[model samples]
Target: MSPIPVELAVDAASAVAANGSPRKTFFGHPRGLSTLFMTEMWERFSFYGMRALLVLYLVAPHDKGGLGLNAATGAAIYSVYNAMVYLLALPGGWISDRLWGARKTVLVGGVIIMTGHFLLAVPASVSFFVGLGFIAVGSGLLKANISTMVGHLYPDKNDPRRDGGFTIFYMGINLGAFAAPLVIGTVGQSSLGYHFGFALAGVGMALGLTNYVLGSRNLSAKSSVVSSPMSRAERTSMLRKGLFWLALAVAFFGAVALAGHLTVGWVTWTLTVVGLIIPVIVFARIRRDKDLSTDERGKLTGYIWFFVAAAIFWMIYDQSGSTLSLFAQNNTSSKLFGFNFPSTWFQSLNPLYIMALAPVMAWLWVALHRRDKNPSTAVKFGIGLALIGLSFGVMMLAMAAASGGVLVTPLWLALVYLVQTVGELTLSPVGLSVTTKLAPKKYASQMMGIWFLAVTAGDCVAAVLQQVMGDAFLSTTSFAIQGAAALLAGVAMVLYRRKVRALMGDVH
Candidate 1:
């Protein structure tokens, strides 16, 4: 899950790719698209590169150049870090609109991200946590704005080519994701050590920054100008609000420390509470909007169901970097063809599977659509949930196969990733497509923030689930529990799909 939700900035349509000097279209798109595509490709390379190693490095023994933390602690950190990245997108968008424009924000964010990775190259606990913080904040600033910049490439919001262009750009993201684990995992999990692997991630960000500079000429100047410059009164209020929150955070941490509850696990759960609350507040505010009609209210009700379903789906799917990565290391064998590979290489499977499977699924759906027989959105989500749940059930079988204490074959995990990819194909695109249409027009821009919050919420609950599993985290019971939750949700969706569709109004 290299960031969910396809809601990029739609308002930047006024900022088309700078057309001049008799330019050519890229794959029938604006020439500037190539620049953005590559920049994003390298940026994603940086992101997924570090993520693949995060939990593994944490739990690895210090003698092996690792932190030696337990699985619960490591997974907790990983989940909250991921949750925070998506959580920050709300403010990231606000910063883009009010302070620096997207272009500057993205550039600064890239530099901060690069600094974070470089800090990660240093092998110290303090550096490790600080590096994670920098990456989260920097990604917050960069990820949202960079994705939004894609919308700037198309001159018209409804341009026939816009969807195709977004599809292609998305492929660039997957390309980087697919390649990262193989490269970073090999180095980090190998004799050269984890720090070197992290350094390589820094180099990847440097390459992304280099690409941005090379492509700067073709970028949107419209992003260089703030759309809604904040008034002085608003600025004063924002400053006061920021100070109040900052002081509150300091006091909260101080109280936690005085209460003898200041620890990684405790902090992680606290952040989880914040992550869970954000979407609730956002949804409540949106529901209270006076502009929404009765029809819009109906769609909003349906969207809530889909949101819950999406959150559950992501809770399982996005565990690849945390629990699944550990399973690959501690439970699954790394041997293949007389050579042992890095367990982290398993991280590459989802994106690679996505690249290979997406088109096949697309063709299948479009073919069915031609006959007007494609599954409804609710059914698609149901099918996706079942597939992912079945994939975890397969892992239960793998655990049974490894009952003799012999590590299971990588193929078992591969089978799981492949099945999950199929499920992803079934649900993910439909989720994005439906989200844009489900929201009221007044809140269209805010929809991206809310949509991504689904991932944030999922990651938060994942932290909760993983922490509560105790020693069973790696056992068949854990698999059964996770698989059953999804299966029950899928069955419910199937049983009530018609009602779900009806609540969606005309959004089919």
Candidate 2:
């Protein structure tokens, strides 16, 4: 019932009622969570729906209405697009902190996202890339901010309900992801065509937008806009500068594209360089701030490991959409129980696994805390890394089984996803919680964006790896190397867990 921590900087009115009585509830949490939960569910529907189709569409033959790109080219495009979706979160956080509030930014993002999905339905070459660009930008705006808004619903930092609440929120994301492939994949791979599937994704986004608008009254009004908004002139200046840089980038790329020399390879390379440099610059700037105390600086340094670990985790996990998707199409058997399913449905396993595991894991976190037995964040991360690494080992075994151009059983891939999902449960939500805990007060709002930069880093490196190695990216040696890196990272985190704990001070 007290004010939220200053480091979070969320207004207290967000969770406190004017009347101060019993409030409406969704499954024993705040009613507002339902709004956020449903909104995110539909947004993910749009995102994963399109995601399930992107690589397949690119690799499909020209006669089948695809772009007819090679596996390498398709993977490159997928990786780059994924990179941009996360990379822009840095600026997206800036925009929300200074101009739009979390609520407004999410709304604007939804509109843009809907537009992008519809554009993707056009079935034109120009529209496809353009649509992806729009969705990336919109998603960047919406992603971190919406998560921040969810924090607003929980005013008490020590409330035991916090982790469980987030688990429910996370489930909303999984719900959308679980359903998208079945619905969109079936439609796209059917007689109706891919563009129709894209359109349906847009329809899902539109539904989400409608739900959000209608439920706005349930959200906190005080937190609907930026707390300290920029002045008109400052806002104008910032916009102008952003536009100038953007125009320069567009012009440069447009000229190259017109000359037919700007390929997916070029875009991915640029993203790789930018992604690698961003974390360095941001980390240095934050670390050097004079306002920080000795303990704060120590914590920031510890965060570097977390950042690197997250990058490694995502690099392998996200390949489900690209490298693994291609494998499903080319190498995995689709027939199960005498019924053939689309390869795209394999992507759904992640969310399905998450759905099944989230509740038990969520309850375990709270119970462990209550019993004073919860593992330190670093240890949890160690478990996560180990699991993801093991998933790769499973992949290597599957590769061996399919050595002579044989189609491996779907069970092999399912096992990989299952192991990886458990790893994700250990690390992903814990990462979000720890990022908010360790972040500096002055830059409270922007911390989520900094967190997302880890994803950008992973995706960029992944794209670059695929680009440089080309077809060799599929080799068992590649999986072995990546898996070993993760396993080693896990061991290092555990061996040095005491140091990280010291760096965290009282937070963990």
Instruction: Return the lDDT, model 2, position 11.
Output: 34
Q: Highest TM-score, which number? A: 1
Candidate 2 to truth, TM: 0.90
| TM-scores for all predictions | 0.93, 0.90
lDDT of 1 by residue, 1-508 (tens): 4223232332333335456344455766766678878888888888998999999898888898989988987887898899999888878888998989999889888898999999999978889888999999998898788878888876567876677778778888999998999998888888899999999999999998998888888876776778778999999999999999999999988998999998777878888899999899988988888889998988998999889888988888888898789888888899977788888889899998887777778788888999999988888989989988898899889888878678888999999999988898888888877899997988887787788899899999988877787556777888888989998998889899999889998888
* Candidate 2, run of 10 with poorest lDDT: 1-10
Name the runs in model 1 displaced over 4 angstroms.
Answer: 1-21, 158-160, 258-260
Query: For each candidate, C-alpha RMSD in Å?
Result: 3.5, 4.5
Worst 10 residues of 1 by lDDT: 2-11
Clashing pairs in 2: none
lDDT of 2 by residue, 1-508 (tens): 0011111122334345678865567776778889989999999999999999998898888889788887877887888789888888787777787888889999999999999999999978789888999999999989858877877777777765565567677778888999999999889888888889999999999999999999888776644868678999998998899899999999998999999989766766877798889888999999899999897888888888899999999888889999888888888999998999999999899988877776678678888999999999999999999998999888888888878899999999999999999899899878877898888787776777887888888988888888888878887887888888889999999999999888888887
